[model samples]
Target: MDIDVFAATHAQEWKRLDELVRRRRSLAGEEVDELVDLYQRVSTHLSVVRSAGQDPNLVARLSALVARARSAVTGAHSSSWSEVSGFFTRTFPGTLYRLRWWWIGASAGTLLVAFLAGAWVVLDPEVLNAMQTPEAMRQYVEHDFANYYAENPGTSFSAQVWTNNAWVAAQAIVFGVFLALPTIAVLAMNGAGIGSSAGMMIVHGRGEEFFSLILPHGFLELTAVFVAGGVGLKLGWTIIEPGDRPRLRALGEEARAAMAVALGLVVVLFVSGLVEGLVTGNMVRGRIATPVGLGIGFFVEVLFLAYVYTVGKRAYRKGETGDIRNTPEAVPVAG
Candidate 1:
């Protein structure tokens, strides 16, 4: 209980702990183990000294030593740059590749719905009328549709488009927890909107114009949406049939993966927004040629798909699951 005796007895161990902490980066395996052992012993000494109402100076010294030792033992976290790099190279693409089928199916289904809706709207004058009056529809096809892109400054317009599309994609992924109905509805509504617009334009003999504007941005934007919808549905399906894992555990895994997809889509949608605002809008304003704009959009879309298949497939093959690394497993409970 004597403060002086306690300090003297543990002085060597404390000094060793300090030395180890100072040289943590260069520590040998045995020295690392010794540092950990000293850390534990010194921690106990500090606790005992405090219990005995010991010397304030000794207490302060031990406190500092223990803090440094703790840091040394735990080591520093991965750098922010490392984390960002890992997410893009491993986590994001791996998730995309792993869930490729789900999103691909989503893309196919949504496109099919859009095509059918467009055809129906073209064939059924009543359907077209139900959507809008003839005058309003004509105005939309000739002016409103084309003008929407060039109405705002390119930077501000890109920001707005990015925000809106990102929110929609986030909704599609986050709402997957509700058994995917919301995700399905989002996809359906999006497809229907596109189809209606296309149908209206085509019927007015402006199909080329519609595509000229839409294709420059729509390819990537729609793909990002399809990815979100697919991931969302997968999350919901986990609730329905979790396979070999516990239902809650499966849901947790999928939910985390869904979050990664959401974050990745932010970057994806930003690029799409840039295309819409800069390339598509410029095309309308006669700032860029139609073929050049279309080529730029197509190149971006192809590059993205190629990145997903190559980087994503490689990462997935290496056992990357797109979930956060080293997440603590849930405690096992006996049924």
Candidate 2:
């Protein structure tokens, strides 16, 4: 292409694209549409110039304009608050609601395993004895279990629990790509710990103390864990059954969706941490602080469930898949 001829022909379009980028904040709806159209045309014009034009100045000018125009075209449509609102309403809860069966399965399977372990230990003297010496078991039940909660300052303990549970939730999502083996192991390991602890405490007649401390935070904390494990397992299962979508595409979609859960769980686990640190460890004079903490956790959980059922149902019905909106270049992907 002759450089001057091409520049002359496309000068008007480039100027319009530049104007749109500059005034993107004040654009009327049709002007915004025109801006996007001009952006595409300018992108094509830049490609043509790079391929055929030898003039460095012309290529550099078009290149800069295209970059600015592309940024304005895409950036104008999104805001930080919009992203947060979208995740809570559609991405996070919709994913949770849509994948409810998997989490329900996780919850049932985990509790069942824990119940069996506790029962086995309680029913058989040999099982509990083989796990630990009587003296050690007594120490753990009467002192260690309860002391563990109060050993640290409340603020420190809350931060510790928050970070630890958040990390576990994240690992559940990231390790999900490996066929969910890691996630299953994590869930089972947690279940066994809880069951063994309960069994020992009950056998030693400290069962009330055990629950008083655990229930305050464990209700919501464990629920978050089960959800994380569920999402991970679901993502892994996408490998076995990609449905109508391509394998990689399905995996990518599920991975992105699971990440939204991971982010949301940070907030959920933080609440659990507050319960553990402030209420389970520290008690009011009436000895009902722990119960109140449990109630708080239960309330938060119910509120979340209500949001998921109401908002998430609507989002899922509207076909929000929980994946981040793709870039312009990715529009051709089937997912």
Candidate 3:
């Protein structure tokens, strides 16, 4: 649709949204929130129209509404404060959290690889030797892992770059593809890497020690990685096969949800590291103790992942019932 035509039709709704913003004093918190949401939807639609092709008329209409809204917020309408709060609390934060999932995965993936490589040195040289060699392990231990971690304390900034690069490359192989094979491949690779490392530790005498060393941090770190991978997979698939909607459009929709998953992953990994470095770091206990700690951590991690990723409450469905938005169908919207 032409931007102008679309804007003209939606002008009244936009106006109402503006009025709500302007008349914040007369409105309740919930009412202001509702209007704000409607306004966002209209704005998104306008964006869509503009992207399709510029319509001077539509641009003019949207520009006017944006100005009005901005004015209301900046003007004497003190109510904008709460609305702003509401936006961050109810809308913007959620959007960001959704974006975080991809970020978290990307971050976690790099960190996990780094951590494993580091662990390869001091934690289990035998496993490292089996996987690569003593020479490789020595290089990683003395140079790679030590240098990397020493330079990158938090791991947030670096992890993001790696994740973004991976996503960008993956996106090419999958043009807005949804649940593409590549996404699954990424997930599987991560899972395998994790499982293999853990399994190898178990096979060697270090297995018991490994859990204690990693459990404190691994609990959150591993779960976050899996979640991030899941979301990334979802994004890839969404891009590959964007059922009903155009691929790009569907990818956008999927991205919002996938990103949320990634954000959660970031929180997990960062916190996990603290636990590893602080709680588990000082305790130089026995092998049995380490494995016991690891076992407990693993159990908790699995349970939490199951609840969050697999068996959680779902959104509602269309036609078949009421409030499907609360069901699986609406899960992404909430994300």
Off by over 4 Å in 2: 1-71, 284-290, 326-335
TM-score of model number 1: 0.78
Better of 1 and 2 by TM-score: 1
Per residue, candidate 1 scores C-alpha lDDT tens digits across 1-335 of 45677678777888788888999999999999999898877777766654443354555566678777877888856678998999999999999999999999889989988999999999999998899888898889889999999999999999999999999999999889999999999999899889988998999999999999999999999999999999999999988998976576567668878989999999999999999999999999999999999999999999999999999999999989976464223332222
Quote the lDDT for 28 in model 3. 85
- lDDT score, candidate 1, position 118: 97
Q: After superposition, how far is residue 56 of candidate 3 from its true place, in Å?
A: 18
Tens-digit per-residue lDDT, 1-335, candidate 2: 47688799889988888988899999999999999999888777766654552554565577678777877887844568997988888888888888888988988988988998888888999999999888887788777888888889888999999999999888877778899999899888888888988988888888887787788788889989999999989988988887876576577668778988899999989988987888787752234565676687678778777888899889988887776443222212111
Each prediction's RMSD to truth: 10.8, 8.7, 10.4
User: Candidates' TM-scores?
Assistant: 0.78, 0.77, 0.47
lDDT of 2: 0.81
Best by lDDT, which number?
1
Residue-by-residue lDDT tens digits, candidate 3, 174-275: 332544556555554654565555554544445555445555556665545544554565567665666876555465556544444344344445555544
Candidate 3: residue 284 lDDT (0-100): 42
